[model samples]
Target: MAMAVLERFAVLSSPDLDEFRHSVSQFLTPHRLTPLAGNTAGVHTDLSKTSVGPVSLVYCRNSGVELGVHLTENVDYYDINLALHGRNRVTFGRDEVVVDASRAAVISPRMRVDMRLSDDYRQLHVRIERQALTDHLEAMLGRSAPAVIRFEPDMDLTGPAARGWLRTVRILLQDLDQPAGLAEHLLAAAPWANLLMTGLLLAQPNNYSPQLERIDAGLRQPTPVRRAMDVIECDPSADLSVDRLARAVRMTPRSLQRHFRSALGVSPHEYVQQVRLARVHEELRLAEPGTVTVTEVALRWGFTHVPRFAGLYRKRYGTPPSQTLRDAL
Candidate 1:
């Protein structure tokens, strides 16, 4: 998957030194980019950026050339740089870390940075907007904070928290490839953005970790119904019968059903079916017109009966699945 993330949003691919510097300055951040290996004769700078909600996923590579990039001022956004191939040394202020696939350097605002890239270095930069992050932090705190949230520079990506956060990133990247997909829907996009933001805030230790921990210690564990719904949402195609879901969440079947009814006003079966219908609706909208059929789409999401699915799809989406596919194409 080298240089695979956000490859569709290519901005530049050139060997010219000035052009390479200009491309990085335009597509990513303003930096003094110079070749460290004497000359950039055979080096190709590849860059791409795709914006999704409050963040942008940028893929960049300077192939066959050691490079040095300097950012002399404080940046406005948080840069989570994950190396895809080879290695790089990112220096944030006085702290420096060697970043690779398993280690990410999270550069927060109010810091100067210097980056040394190996000859084969390639990376994906998750650029989170400053204002959006501040707003999210305020929402999480349930109050205004006068001080900015500053994250520790080096993030260990081997932990479960980082892995889960990366899942949301992969989901967003997948959606960005679809013309009529979840990222384009406000309702869906907001949750994904919130999931990413909330995950990062909770997973990574920051200036507000102590406060967040205090708040969390005072609250009860997340409701089982929410976990069940997350299971379905994360992988709707999984076997999600009430028995399985209840077992997954360590609850009895009857108790799980009761909780689902009380919280969602629907039984587990109904909720799963609703999720499947929604998934089918999304699939139809993102599928190519000539490549798929309504029945195929229905069955993929576990809707076996054609007539019932058509009726449900129409009632839920106000259109037949075929019509949605047609519109998408």
Candidate 2:
């Protein structure tokens, strides 16, 4: 499971140099901050953070300083720094990158980073939990990833895809600031966070890119039924259309339908519905009392019509979804 992000904005700031470092460490990561020689001006730090599900968005600005950040032993998540002003030299393991307006730095969960920031440095930091990303990679490949996914340190933000990612970040930031933002609702937050994760995986070059390309090219092989099952199990919430499943396994829809009927005794569409209904039932069973509704769980698993979904749920489980929820509570 992915780590949950904060549900509301948190602001941390301090004028004392040592206090500033301590505050930042508590909010983000543990690190030592050292003011450069002859740069003894009052230390000022400001950070505003909001979490959209499992992703954390942080806006940070600090006075002139150098930081010695250590994650060698406790590398738990991926951190991406997009420079908004000034400059930074970020070193990860043996590699280093100069981060500026045009370049972003991606620090993997396995690496230790040391950063040197210029006087007017400001940045947007995106933190993604490792498990969440790993799950996504597995979904994309229709199988478990072989190892931890690694990303190129330097990302060119001038590219078209990168620009689109930035646009999404901006939109999320704007919504976070609004009193009635989309992120305030769980239903909306889930998709928005998922979009950010998917966007980064697609726009950036990563260790899994080659394998994903192979799948897209329809080169390597998996049995049609096995591949289809993998896709459904990996992401039961996806829109699992017959055509989509057919293309994923490199088979015509007609052939897929015939095979599914012959082997599973059900059409592809029916199988998808069964998977979704099971997912909804599991969620309802585990959901906190009074915090979630049957409709929300149904919609989350792609069931749009309440009457139709309830009828199917009853037929499958011998009880209405509302009754299932009540029993769980």
Candidate 3:
């Protein structure tokens, strides 16, 4: 038997159409499901949900049955659906898309949706709330035009940004599935949730994509201070004490400390903490959720005391180290 996605949070389980309808109705509104086959005997179905931040990660699959879904009402969310294996069809009037492991179907809000799902169509549904997405876009563009948002019908999962997006999704789902996962604390989980939305907005094209592209192009790398900051950032997990940084930058320890404080308002030691904290954040986001821990990340960045590192991380990011191990899709 294949491992079920989101199996830790099963929300529905049924053998056929009637029970599936009844069980799923309470979960969604203004939608209907019908079996295309004359009979659905011996077919097994399962559904699960994990809500994080402003989005819901939903999983559903069937043993082997042709099913149709209709959404006629104006909905309030977007469902970016990806099948782990097999294929599914989605149509918006004349436009249509086929989604599988390398492609995704973005079901936008308020659109008339017609769907055909068959066989072992196991899928992970990234359900993001419509207005929250709109709000996030406004913040990203630094404007509040009071306009709604829409996206292209399909997403290519093969591109670099899209692949990163998928990895982030895996991180979010796999990490939260654990007993001591990032979902426990709002401080950690909420930002990660926002980050997931942000990644989707940036990765996939939308109405404001041109402007987003412009903004992305405008971003410049941070300038290093006397090349010492550059060396420290190159490998933040190194022994970046004042003496070491001074040697690298060709200055006495006292001179290096004074220069760092004068240029950045922090001593060499304090500056290293900022860089190491950022490295930890970067690593946590990219780390395989089930395999890496916050403690491991801190120690890797030369943080000897886990509690002190946690405090600094929380203060700097308004989130904890563990909560950051997820994002995207």
Candidate 4:
């Protein structure tokens, strides 16, 4: 099966800074951030609250050749930056590095550094209370963080993980002005926060026992149904019988059926068919010339026997797959 690189999340962007500051102050002690020359940077208070901490997202955009940032004072909290677009030259402690799209970097508390961008760039900046992250770290590692971590931006660590983290951040960032309870929404972001931290911890290999525990605990979180859905999504053409899907998630067929029915109000077979048809419909919208045949696409998503597939397709979409592909052309 081809690995379709799915975009899991996006980052927050804004034109409002006052609201951003108020939201950030909920979690971190507010400090005046000196703006960088030749770039636009703003922090917006998202009215949402997460389980991990209060929500505030920052955006920095540089439209010219380069932008540089110098931290003069030692901060008492943890901060993370993800280059959403273009490139950056970062100097942290004794390390000097260049980071571009698909890469992320972190600066430890009290670590003064200089950051330079080589092209027009935008980045998502997240600041967390030092003690909150420290508690998580200590719980995972069984000790305190070494005074500092000198990070050299590496694509391997940042590419996939950073993309995933930013996608989730962007979602919460949107609820900032909806006249809703920001605190509850922000608190619910704990899972995302945990995932972000887990990715960072995995980035640097250290003997932190508590940190390991946290990651392990996250893995143990009940997600069998989600996992089963993912399997269905990955290869819709497979034999997705009730017993088979149940086995994939390590649950009994009866148990799985009961749980899915309770949660989604649909039978497993019906759900799988719906997913499979949806995939066919999507492909039909942009299917390439001749490469994706009506018969092939249908069979691929577990619709064996062209007549049955065609009948089902017509019933749901009011058009056949052949019509879809032809229109796409």
lDDT of each: 0.78, 0.76, 0.76, 0.58
Best by lDDT: 1
Residue clash pairs of candidate 2: none
Give the Å error, residue 227, model 4.
Answer: 25
Give the better candidate number (1 or 4) by lDDT. Answer: 1
TM-score of each: 0.65, 0.64, 0.65, 0.43
Model 2 lDDT per residue over 179-200, tens place: 8878888889778878888888
Candidate 2: clashing residue pairs, number: 0
RMSD of each: 15.2, 11.6, 14.4, 20.8
Question: Any idea what lDDT model 2 has?
Answer: 0.76
What are the per-residue Cα lDDT tens digits for candidate 3 across 144-246? 3234678898999999988888888888777777877877577786787788888888888988777667545433312334567677767878888787777
Candidate 2 off by > 4 Å: 1-10, 64-74, 218-329
Worst 10 residues of 2 by lDDT: 1-10
Clashes of each: 0, 0, 0, 22
TM-score of 4: 0.43
